[model samples]
Target: MTAFILVAGAHTGGWVWRQVAAGLRDSGARAYEVTLTGMDGGGGAAEPGVDLQTHIEELVRLIDRIEGQDVVLVGHCYGIHPVRGAADRRPGRISRIVHVDVGVPEDGDPALKLVPDQTDRERVLSLARENGAGTLPAPTVQEWQRWGSVAGLPDDALARLTEQAVPQPLPTLTQPLRLSGAVAEVPTTGVLCTANGSSIAVVEAMVGLGDPAFQALADPRVTFFELETGHWPMLSAPRELVNVLLRAAAGKGHRVAAVREQPTHLRPFLMDVEERPRERTGRVDLHLPDADGPRPAVVFVHGGPVPAGARPTPRDWPAFVGYAQYAANLGAVGVTVDHRLHELTAYGRAADDIAEAIELVRADPRVDGERVALWFVSAGGLLAADWLAAPPSWLRCVAASYPILAPLPGWGLAGGRFRPAAAVRGAGRLPIVLTRVGLERPEIAVTVEEFVSAAADCGAALEVIDVPLGHHGFETVDPTDASRDAVRRAVRSVLGHLRVGTD
Candidate 1:
């Protein structure tokens, strides 16, 4: 019989996995819910010296005692640190390693780095030091959202989780996990919790960014499953978690394609147009029209969460260059910009960069300050929300191509700051153009549909150009006549809007 070892995240012990353990047992599998050292019912405050290594040793001993049985080790959130350390040590004995809603950290990476927010990390460290203890207290019930989304949890579950939670050892978060590289050979499964802001689509996007760090995710030995609940699926959807675990153990889950030598965005643009000379000014590049006397301008915003070290940034990309040149040929000044949208959390900084770029473009002697259109693509689409919320008179039109109108679940964006769908209600009299593809990812397509519905409900002047057989980056990926025609139509529509007040 196959034996499963379940490890919970910080502050909680084996007790958190009670329902999951019982569910696995009902399926004729042996389940062991582990409470790491220093956690409640697992030596607790008595083991003040408990660190990451101590937790790893605890799991290693359990795996050693389960003689002659196939072991599948499961780790949730912070528990992944020790689970990976243990798996690295016993790769030959482990059948599969299941990672629940957390990224697999590299050797020497501390759990403290996984917190994401710098403020929260400092707060955690301060709390541990001020308490005069070596432990960080669990977040209160009111503060639970800071840890992760509590979308599917019931009132009872929330209260129970808060009541049963214990202070976490400081060493576990600060101490790094040591790996000998053996765990890379072990089959791996990733259970992504979509409601908590992680989804396979996001993983695919990361891989598409041409980052070497994300390339390993395409390995055949690794697979993925997505849960529609928040972080704690054991409490919110135990039965579903059990079912997914069973399927994962059987090596049946979604497989992400390997990164191609050339990512879709890097492919050549669909439209063919004559090249125009571009004048580089700071971060913005201006492609001026031949017969220009203060020509109307179109600012092309590229998609991101791009790596900080990416070569030949967005402004120099083939599609951006192609669109810029095409606009210049159409008697309009084409502008492309480079912004520091290096991560999902850097949207605010990117927005500021775009705003600065626009101001510079408007001030240029070769561009018309009164007439301008904003064109956003892919992930950059969320940046359009600000302009749509309260468009200035100088802003003639806004256009998006395969845009993410709403934030994805795991992004953790608060309020309507970057949500274009919510801001569409305030887009009175502003001409908005949207280009959508048929073969887009479900997660992104849903956001597009939501924005469309909201625009209709609010009676916003929204124009949608549908590419029925195209993919997300269809301008490059699907370089058919349809793709070229769609691009031409979108450019024409935006240029038409720019000319409305001028003529």
Candidate 2:
């Protein structure tokens, strides 16, 4: 008799496997059902959020606890997450891994990026926010059943199933499965259920043949089975599920079986765009969405165009924390662009190209046709400041940090044609620069004074903040308390000037 180890899905305890275990035990096989963390009637793990690693740990414990020297691991729904993990831990001792009516483990893809699409991502995030007090939410047992096709189950079994459901930790669902030393090379079988004709068909199809993101699981060593039933096959078709498991345990090959309907692909056609060559165009290109009304857009045409591998990250004589997603999350479309070849572009060329990119963003639906702002750091900012001297009607706001060579000659001031104070003098409002008293360089102070003075003439709001501890890039290291404070203030100031709302 084989020792069968069963792994339950999300929000389910080991009790859900009782009937199947009994059937196997009656057949003279020892069956062990493994319950994941937070499902054994405990308060659930708090503080350090539970992730894929944590679930894998629990599974390892279950496998180690079994008295026999043999066991066949079975997983259902999210059970695939840990079953794959255990297989990697000990391949020799385990006989076979069975994924029962479950979504295939998506290897290499970020877990947080799951769900059907971006719109769904937003919905999930909204749900998480509503349930977990501004954090991620752990769904209740009742809630999870609603997500599946459970109406087809017999009333008696359905009632017991709900009673056995335990709230699962939200962290396990969201955390990306790190695969450095994690397991994947074990003999496995997928019992895919796709008869619901539901939106979950995507996930069902993925279980039959996992998504492209984590597609390495479809190797020759892996076996596939089809279960034509509702999502909860344990209650709806446990005999069929168990039969497949028995074949796997017996190490049999080519065991013919019946299924309601086989999965079919729509024969997707690929149109991947490969860039054709272009010679020394030296022009700006903007890509925007098609929509009515104003949309938020961010055009970042600021990199120094350093040769490949020469420059590691962006340059800030005084470093600065980059906010790539910060703008994207605020309903604004953010763009990151590399500047044209040279530092100085034929006098008026830089401004003109910047203007082009801005127009492209303004016309994009995702950007709401709103006049998007420009982002330039150091050298780029210096040029941007020079162009801001005579602003356009659509140009809503302008912001630059540690701008070029100022008249007063700051610590980083060098021989450059552009002066940092130029934008300050021309602006109706003041431009902002990152600075602090303790770490202040005399040259930076001069730069600030020059820009502040110019901003005063233009009647523009001028802000020269003396950041307490650091000069720039405060939030690069640990998401520390002090760094977060400084970055938050800086973000608010910039957004306020741009007339964008931040909640």
Best by TM-score: 1
Candidate of highest lDDT = 1
Q: What local lDDT score does residue 137 receive in model 1, on the 0 to 100 scale?
A: 71
In model 1, which residue pairs have backbone atoms overlapping below 3 Å? Answer: 197-409, 197-410
What is the per-residue lDDT of model 2 for residues 1-503, given as tens digits with 9 covering 90 to 100? Answer: 68898878766767877778877877788888776656675544343456667888877787787766667889876677777777677666787878775545555543334332233346556655665322333444444333454635787777777666665555666666555443555666767565432222223333332234323443545666666665677777877777777877776433222222432222111111222211111233232223234555555544332322322222211122134345444444445544443322222355565666666556555454545565554445555655466555555555554443352211112233345456445555434434233343433445556666766666665554444664322333223455456555654566565666732
- Model 2 / residue 51 / CA error / Å: 3.9
Which 10 consecutive residues of model 1 have the lowest summed lDDT?
40-49
Deviation (Å) of 224 in candidate 2: 1.7
lDDT of all the models against the reference?
0.88, 0.53
Model 1 ranges with Cα > 4 A deviation: 41-47, 116-122, 125-163, 166-171, 178-182, 250-252, 309-312, 425-428, 449-459, 479-483, 500-503
lDDT of candidate 2 at residue 223, scale 0 to 100: 63
Superposed by TM-score, candidate 1 places the C-alpha of residue 144 at a distance from the truth, in angstroms, of 4.7
lDDT by residue (130-209, candidate 1, tens digit) is: 65346777779986766777879999999999989988888888888889999989999999998777889778867776
